[model samples]
Target: MVREIMEEGLLTSRYQLPPNETKPTSNGADGDGLTDNLNMPSQPAASSLTLVLVFCTFVAVCGSFSYGCSLGYSSPAETGIMEDLDLSLAEYSVFGSIITIGGMVGAILSGKIADLIGRKRAMWFSDVLCTVGWLAIAFAKNALWLDIGRLLIGLGVSIFCYVVPVYIAEIAPKSYRGSFASSNQLMTSSGFAIMFFVGTFISWRTLTMIGAIPCVVQIIGLFFIPESPRWLAKCGREKEFEASLKRLRGENSDISEEAAEIRDYIATLEQQTEASFLELFQRRYANALIVGVGLMLLQQLGGNSAVVYYTSRIFKESGISGSLGLQVLAVLQVPAATIGLLLMDRSGRRPLLLVSASGLCFSYFLQGLAFCFKELPNLKALTPPLALSSTLIAATAFTIGLGGIPWIIMSEIFPINVKAQAGSLVTLVNWSTAWIMTYSFNFMMDWSLAGTFFFFSGISGLTVLFVAKLVPETKERTLEEIQASITHFM
Candidate 1:
C-alpha cells in the first residue's frame, strides 16, 4: 500500500493530471490572476523557461562562488601567510585543513537549518557567516586568527555544499533542471578560477577582502528571488506556494495541474509517520543513502580537493613554475565546468560519472608514473612536464563530471519526506572524508608522491566500478519520478 501510494504521488507529480480533477486553489480568488480550469491540461507555462529562473539561479549560486573563494584562498595565501606570520609547515597545514573541520560540523547541521528556515533564509544565514569569515581572514594578525577565520569560512562552505545545488534544483523547470543545477558547480569552479587568476596580481589580504564581495551580492540578491515552490508547498503555505509556483511558471501559465500534483505528493508524505534519523536505516532508503554518501566518499577520497588545495606546492616540488601552473589551472577550470554544464542534461548521469571516474584514474596513474620516473636520474627532466600535464588533465576531467554530478544526484535521488536527513547524512560523509583526505594529503605526499597518486588512482578506478554498478541515470526525470524509481530498484 505504501509503495502504491508513492507511485501514485510520483506519477501525478511528474505528469499532468486528468481534466476531471479539480486543482486545489483559493476558491477562484487567487490574486495572481489564476483561473479555475475544469477542462484544461496540466502543462508548464509557455513562459516556464523565463528570465526570472535564470536570474534566481544566478543569485543562488553566488553563494557557491563564495564557497570556491574560501577553498582557493589558502592556496595562494599559503606562502604569504606563512612568511608574514613566521609559521611552520605544520601551522600552515592546520590553517589549510581546518576549513574541512568546520565543513564537517556544518554539513551535519545543514539540512536541519534549511528545513527549519526556508531555502532563501538558509542562504542568507550562510552569506552572513561567510562574510564574517572573510572579514576575519582579511585582518588576521596571527596564526590563531587565520585558523579561526578559515574555520568560519569552512562552516559557510558546508552549508553551500547542501543548499546551493538543492536550491537550483528546486527552482529550475524540469526541462532545464540539470543544466541549471550544473550552474552551482560552474560558479564554484569560477570562484576557484577567479581567485587563482586574481591572486596573481593582488596581496593575500586584498584577496581575502575580495572573497566577501560575493557574499554581499548573494545576500542582497536573495531579497529579490522567490523561495522554492516545493519548499513552500511542503510547509503547507498554500497561498505563498501558489504565488511562488505562479511566479516561476509565469502569470498566465496553467499551474493548476502542477499545483495539484505537488499538493498530492505532499499529502501522501503527510500520511506517513514522521521519520527520525534512525528510520533512515530502513531498507527502503538504503539505495539512495548508499548512492548519495558513496559518491561523496569516492569524490573526496579520489584526491580532487587535496590536489586543488595543494596544486602550487605540488608544482614547486616537481620543478615547474608554481605560478605558471596555477595560471593554467585558473584558465582551464571554468571552460571545463562550462562544458559540463552544457552536457549535464544532454548526456545521462551514469555515462558522465563513468567517463569522469575513468579519466581521473588515468590522470592520477600518469602522475604516479611521473613521480616514479623522478627517481631515475636519466629521466628526471621528464617529470616536470608530465606532472604539469597530468594536473591539468585531472583538473579538467574532474570538473567535466565528478565535480558537479555528485551534488546533482544528491539533490535528485531522495524522497521529500527524508530529504533533510538524507542530504545532511550524505553531506556529512562528504565533508568528513574531505577533511580526512585533505588533512592527510601533505603527510601522504611526504611519504611518497608516487604512492600518493597511485593510491588516488586506485580509488578513482573503484569510483568507475561504483558508478557503473550502482548509480542510476537521472536525466530528464522529475524529482518525484527519480525517487520512486530508485526505491523500486532497491
Candidate 2:
C-alpha cells in the first residue's frame, strides 16, 4: 500500500516505508526488503546544542518583543518627546507607522530571501538590520531620522518573526515540534514583559537602544547551531542534509529511518516545483491561504496589539496615574503570557484560540461596562487604580487568547514551498493591522476608554465566531501533514 501510494505520488516520501519492511525490527526499523545502510547513532541525550538552539530562538524572538515593547511604550512617551522635538501627533503616528510599513515590505520579501539564501543567512541579515536600526533610533535628532530608524527595525522584526518559527519548526523533531515552536511565543512575551520594566526605568531613547543588545547575542549564537536539515534538503544538498540531521539528531544516533523519511518528502516537493505565489490563490492552495490570512487578520482584530501598545494609555484614562501603572501592566503581562505559553502546546491550537477569544470578549465586555459605570451614582467612588487593574486583567486575557497563537497558526498552516511567502503575507497583515490600531488608538482613547474597549471587544467577539467556524486544529501535525490537511480545506 505504501509503495503504491509513493509510486502514485499520493504519499509524501516522509511517510514512505522502507523497500522491504515486511516486519518491524527491535530498533524501530522496519525489516522491509530494503537494506538499512545508514545506522543512526544511539540518540544523543539532549545536549548543549539543543540549549543553544533554544537560546538562539529566544534571542531572535527577543528582537521582536523589543520592537513591540519599544513601539508600545514609546508611543505614550512621545507626548513628552514631541515637545522636546517639535513634532505633531500625526507626525509621531507616522513615525510609528513606518515600522509597520517596513514590516509589511519585509514580511513580503523575507520569505523569498530565506528560501533562496537559507534561514541562517536570513537571521544574520536580520541581526545587522536590527543593530543599524537601533543605532539610528538611539542617535536620531529629528522625527524623520526616528521614523527611518523604526522602518529599519520593522524590517528586521518582519524577517526575524517569520524566519524563527520556520527554522524552529523545520529543525525540531515531530514529537517536540509543538513545544519548540511555542518557545518562540514564550520568548516574545518574555521580551514584552522585560521591555515594560525596561521602559519604566529608562528614557524611551535609552530603552530603544537597549533593544539592540539581543541581536548581538543572536548573531553570535547562530555560529553554534547547524543549518536546518530541511533547508539543506530543499537546496538539493543531500549530503549536507544528512550531516545536519546527524548533528541535530546526534552523531551517534540512528537516523537511517529519519533520513529515508526526509528524502521521500523532498522528492515529493521536487515533483511539484511549478507552485508559485500566485498558485497560492488558485483553488488548490486557496483554502490554506484563506486560513492563514484570516487568522492573521483575526489576530489583529482581536485587539492584542491595541492593548499591548496602549496599556499605559488605557490605564491612565481609567484614572491610574504615573509611569507605575505602565509598570504594573507590564508586570502582569509576563505571568499571564507565561501561563498562556505553558498551556499552548498541551492545549492544542484550535481550542486555546477559541477559549482565549471568548475570554477576551468577556473581558472587553466587562471593561466597557466598567467605563460606562465609572460615573454611575454608586460606583463614582471606585479608585482609578482599581479601574486600571480591571483593564489590566482584560489585557491579560487578550494576550493569552489571540496574541501568540496567530503566529503559531500562521507558521504551521502552509507547506514548505509557499510557507515563507504565505507566512509573510499573513504577518504583513498582522503588522499592518497593528499599525492601524497603534495609529488610531489615541483617537479612540480620546473618544472614550469604554468605547475603545467596546470596539476591541466587538473585534474579539467576531474572531471567536470566525475561528470556531473556520479554523482547523493544527496541534501535533508535521509540516507535510499540515500542508495536506490545509489542502483539503482549500
Candidate 3:
C-alpha cells in the first residue's frame, strides 16, 4: 500500500532561481559551481527545499511503475496471449515466469551496473531495455518472441527494483528517507493497478505497448535529474558531488554539514578492505547479510509473485468470476500503499513487518479455506466473496509492510563499500526464489490449490518469527548510523 506524503518544509517554499546562480563551468568540483563559494557552516542544517529531490524521486520511480506493470501484466494478458499464440499452459507459464529468470541475471549485475555506470545511467539503461522488451511483446506473433520480450523486461525490472530504492535512499534526508524511498513501491502499485484495469479491455499486445510509455518518460527524465551525490563522492568526484547535493538541497539551503558527513563516512569505508560478493558471508557481516537476504527470501516465498501473476487464473480456476476481485484489488491497493507510506517512519520497520507477516498468515489461511470450501457440501456458494476477501486482505497486509520495507532496510543497512556485493546477492536470491515459485505455480495449483496456499501460509508464519528475532528497527537514523548499529556489535 502506498500514499503520497508531501515531504515537510518543501511543498510551499517560495521556489525561485537565484539571479546570480550561474551554470557550473565543468564537471569537476566546480561543475555545480558551489565549491569556491560554498560555505563550510558549523551549524546543523535546518531543512532542505525538496522540489528537486521530489522530481528526482519521481523519475526514479518511473522505473518502479514499469516494474509493477511487468508483474501485473501477465494475469490480464494470459488468456488473450494463449489464444493468440496457441500457447500451451506450460509454455504460457514459462512466459509468465521468464521474467524472474531475467531478474536473476539482472540482480547479479545490478549493483555492479550502478557502481560502474552511476545510478542515473543504470536507470536509463534499464529503461532502454524495458522499452525494447515492451516493443518486442507488442509485436510478437509467437511464443518464443513473447518469452524473449518478457525476459528482457524482467532483466530491466530487476535492475530497477534494486537501483531505484537505493538511489532514493542515498539522495533523501534521513528524516524523509523512509517515506520517499517507499514511494518506489507506491508507483509500482499504481502501475500494477492501472494494468489490471486496462488489460481487461485491451489486447495483450496493446497493453504491452502501454507499459513502454513510462520507460520513455523515465529515459528522457534521466537527463534532468542529478546522480546520487553519495555515488559521485564514492567515485571521488568531489566537485560534482557538492554541486549535485547543493542542487538537491535547493538553491539557498546550506549543504556543508551533510556533505562533510557523507565525505567522512565514505572516507571511513575506504579504510576497510572492501568485501567481494562471497566475502559478504563473513561473520563480521553476518547480521546485515542475513537480515538482507533473509527478508528477500521470505518476501518471495510468501507467494506474492505467484499470486499476483495469476490472480485471474486463480479466480477462474475456482469457478468464480475474477473481474470483480481484480477490480477490488486495484481499488484496494491505493489505501494499502497509502497506509504503508503514512506509517513507514511513524510505526518503524519491525512492528509493521511483524503485523504484516501475521496478517499474511491469516489471509493465506483464509485463501486456502476458500479454495477448500468448494469441495464440501453446500459450501460452493461461499467461495466467491470469501476468496475475494482473502485476496484483498493478503494484498493489503503484504503492501503495508513485507512488500517494501525489506527494500528500505536493505538500502539502509549496507555500507556503501559492500552495498553492491550485498545488494546483488540479496536481489539475486529474491529473483531466484521468485522464479521457482512463479514458474511452478500453475503446476502447483493443479497439484492442489488448497495445499499450495496452506504452504504459503506456513511460510508467512515463519516469516513472522524471522522478523521478530532478526530484523531491526531502522527508523530516523542516518545510513552511517544504521549500518554501524547493524554490523558493529563486536
Candidate 4:
C-alpha cells in the first residue's frame, strides 16, 4: 500500500512537482505560498543561507589539503628527503604515485558506501581516515611507512571529493546551485594556498600535520548539517527527507514542493534496474562514461599536476633563485581560482572550458619555446622568470577550468540508477590519471624539459579539441535534461 502511494504520488508529480504545490494549507488563497516566498528574495536576509553554504563548502573542501600538501610539499622536498633516506627517483615516484593509487581504489569503493550510509556518514569516515593517515606520516621513520600513510590520506581525499559535491548539489536550491557547487573549487584553491604557505615556513612533517587539522574540524561540522534529502528518499526514509528539507529550506518555508520532487526522482530511480560496472560500457551510459573518463584524463594530461607537483623544481630549473618564486606562484593560485569561481556560472561550462584549455596550451607552448631557446644570448636573461611564469599561468588556467568541473559534471551527468557506480568509475579514472601523470613527469623532465612542456602542450591542445567536439554544455540544465542529452549522444 505504501509502495502504491509512493508510485501514485511520484507519477502525479512527473518526477518533481511544481514549486506551487507547497501552497499554505494546500489552498489557493495565498496563491502558492512557497512560490510567493521564494520570489520575495531579500539581499541581506538571503545572505545568511549563502553563508551557511559557504561554511559547509569550506569544511567539505578541506579534503583538498591532503592532495595539495602532498603535491606541493612532497614534490619539492622529495630530493631532500631521498638524500636522507637513500632512495632513487623511481622509488620516490612509486611512493608519490601510491597516494593516487589509493585514491583510485577509494573512489571506486566509496560511492556505494555513501549511497548506503549517507553522504554525511561517508564524510565522517573520510575524516577518520585522513586523521589516521596524517598521524602515520608524522611519525614515519621509513619510506614504506610514508607511502602507507600517503595511501590512507589519498583514500580519504578521494572519498571526500566524490561525496561533497553531491551533497551540495542535493541540498542547494536551483537558483543557487552554481554558486554553491563552485564553492568546492574555491575551497580547494584555499587549501592549496594554505599548504603552500605552511610548507614554506615549517618542516614537511609539520606541514603534513597542519593539513590534517581541517579534517578534524570537518568531522565535527558534519554532525551539524542535515543529511542529503535525496539520499534519504532513496532509502525510503520519507519522514527523514521531509524533516531534512524543512531544516535546509527553513522552518517557516513549506517543503511539500521539494518533497514531491524528491519523491518523483526516487520513483524514476525505482523503475530502473541496478547498475554494475560492466554496464558502464552499455549503450545507454557509455557516452557519459567516456566523457567522464575523458575529462578526468584530460585534466591531468593538461599539465596542471606536473606544474603543481614540480613548481619549485620548475622555478629552480628556470634559474629563479630561492623558494620565493614558488611562494609567489602559490599565492597567485588564490586569485586565479577566485576568478574561476566567479566566471563559472556566468560564462557557462563549455565556453570557460575551451578558453581555459586554449590559454593552458598557449602557456605551455611559450614555456617550451623559452626552454628551447635558453641558450640564446638575448633571451637568456629573461628565460628563467618567463618560463616559470608561463608554467604558473598554465597551472592556474587548468585549475580554473578542469579541476572542479570534472567532479561536478561527473556527479550530475549519470542517471540516478547508475549515479553512484558511474561516479565512482569516473573518479577512479581521475585518480589513476593523476598517478600516471605524476609518476611519468619526473622521467619526462629527465629526458628534456622542452620535451616535457611540449608533451603537455600537445595534450592541452587535444583537450580543447575534445571539448569542442564531444563535451556538451551543462550549465543551468536540470539533471534529467542533462541525462536525456547524454542518452541522445550515446
Question: Per-residue lDDT tens digits of candidate 3, residues 413-482?
Answer: 8888889988899999999999988877878898998999999999999999999888877766667656
Clashing pairs in 4: none
**Model 2 regions more than 4 Å off:** 1-49, 52-56, 375-377, 383-386
Candidates ranked, most accurate by TM-score first: 1, 3, 4, 2
lDDT, candidate 2, 1-490, per-residue tens:
4533343345233443566653335443222212222222223233224554565456556555655554454644565557868888778777756777888888888888788899888988988887888889788888988888889888988888788878877777654666677666666666666667666666767777667877887888777777888889878898999987777765666777667756666677676654567756655567677777887887776666666666665666666664777667667876777777677667767777888777777777777777777768688546464567566766676567566677777777776777767877787888888778777777887788688878878887888888877787666455665665454442
In terms of lDDT, the poorest run of 10 residues in model 3 is 3-12
lDDT of each: 0.84, 0.70, 0.84, 0.72
Error of 3 at 388 (Å): 0.8
Clash pairs (backbone) in predicted model 1? none
RMSD of each: 6.7, 6.0, 10.8, 6.8
| C-alpha lDDT of residue 232 in model 3 | 99
RMSD of 2: 6.0
Which sections of candidate 4 miss by over 4 Å?
A: 1-52, 83-91
Model 1 scores what on Cα lDDT?
Answer: 0.84
Tell me the lDDT of candidate 3. Answer: 0.84
| Candidate 3 global TM-score | 0.90
